[model samples]
Target: MFQDNLTDLLENVQNGALSITDAVSRLKTLPFEDLGYAKVDHHRSIRNGFPEVIYCEGKTTDQIRGIFLVLMRSENNILATRASSENFAGVRQIAPNAVYYQQARCIVVNPVKKNQDANHYIAVVTAGTSDIPVAEEAAVTAETFGNHVERIYDVGVAGLHRLLAQLDRLRKADVVIVVAGMEGALASVVGGLVEHPVLAVPTSVGYGASLHGIAALLTMLNSCASGISVVNIDNGFGAAYSASLIIKEIMNGCQE
Candidate 1:
């Protein structure tokens, strides 16, 4: 339950539309729900403005299914990351409403009526073709959280002109997530040009000295450009989540 949901519930009670016992029963799972294998945070949306997301890696099919079932009951949007095709098929079988994002290895289900007009837009930029999987992960994660996303792929530092040409589009976004590997210089270059926040993600797509993305991570962290932040190696989901938060803050600020 989010703050709005809880406030509305309380208002209903005070107005005598709902009995006190019934309201209490509905809020019994305000903080969390304990399922033997996992502690589901049902009240995360109430506290954080977004629901708890499920990490599918290293989890069995049954555990994911159980968690998914309980989470769906709350009408909160569902997100499962690092899920395999087989797992997606299983989830689809159980919840036909869920949609699978193959490239990102994610599954999302929307219980609420779709919000056709998205409030904010995010631009996802990638350094090269090899970095697409990570880029796709960031794109899907942001979209799952209700942000409209525009993709700019294979515009790495190797071809600076290509990225320069998109400056107008980049400047229009609420937030920009730059996915890169190798030396990870693209994020710095993008950060220098755009006024919005840039989320840099380093992928494990470089040669031996790349240290499986350490070089990129370090490069991004040491970026001289302002407004650039780096997430862990291959952590596209984390970058997306952070970007979404930044965008949401800007959106809320605009309303004020």
Candidate 2:
């Protein structure tokens, strides 16, 4: 839609059919659409380089469908996080091409085109098998944004050798996202090993003594490793979004 609008504006100017003031007026309204219930920000793509993401957890099925239809009319790609199968069913009524990733709990419509950065990817590492769901959420989020993602699962501190063996792969990433529960020591460990930025995600995967991830969250916040940074508890989506920004900057730098 952005391309279409630009083409139309340039053609009208060449044909002398519309003045510059009229073009500016149309472009001004392109920034946003007021749906009464929700004021959708279409300018996000111009500002942030990505369209607005739909967070489907609190919204009703009808509301989600309405927003989805609005965005679908303009963009080729769309993403919805923390969505259930029922929410996906609602979205499919408007976007039949939508796909639901069960483990990631994410829905994607018309996934973005991949770039040449598949080899220069983001790495998502998990401390244990139980943390894979959160890890998968991070992985899918990164992939949907057109970043290639490599997943390294079950390499927690419990087995030092398993993590050590994957050092070569971890070092190759542009950025890393570590998902762990319990002690959350995996983030510090990976941070110490990799030269890239590490985004730690604390999951609510531990027992009562783990305080439903508070212990792990605090441990990550106090990481001894210099490059380690922490996101909110069980917030795989947030971690991935940060990683995507870093990856985009790195790629842009390389292109320059």
Tens-digit lDDT string for candidate 1 (15-129): 9999998887777555466787998887677556678888999998888888899888875569998999888878876799888888888888764433523446899999999
lDDT of 1 at 199: 91
Clashing residue pairs, backbone N/CA/C < 3 A, model 2: none
Candidate 2 per-residue lDDT, tens place, 1-256, comes to 5557767887997899989888766665563666778777776766677778888888998888888888887776688888899999988987888999999999999866777476789999999999998998899888888888989999999998999999999999989999999989999999999899999999998999899999999999998899998999989989988999898888888889
Q: Give the TM-score of candidate 2.
A: 0.88
Q: Give each model's whole-structure lDDT.
A: 0.86, 0.88
Q: Pick the candidate with the highest lDDT.
A: 2
Q: What would the TM-scores of all predictions be?
A: 0.87, 0.88
Backbone clashes in candidate 2 total: 0
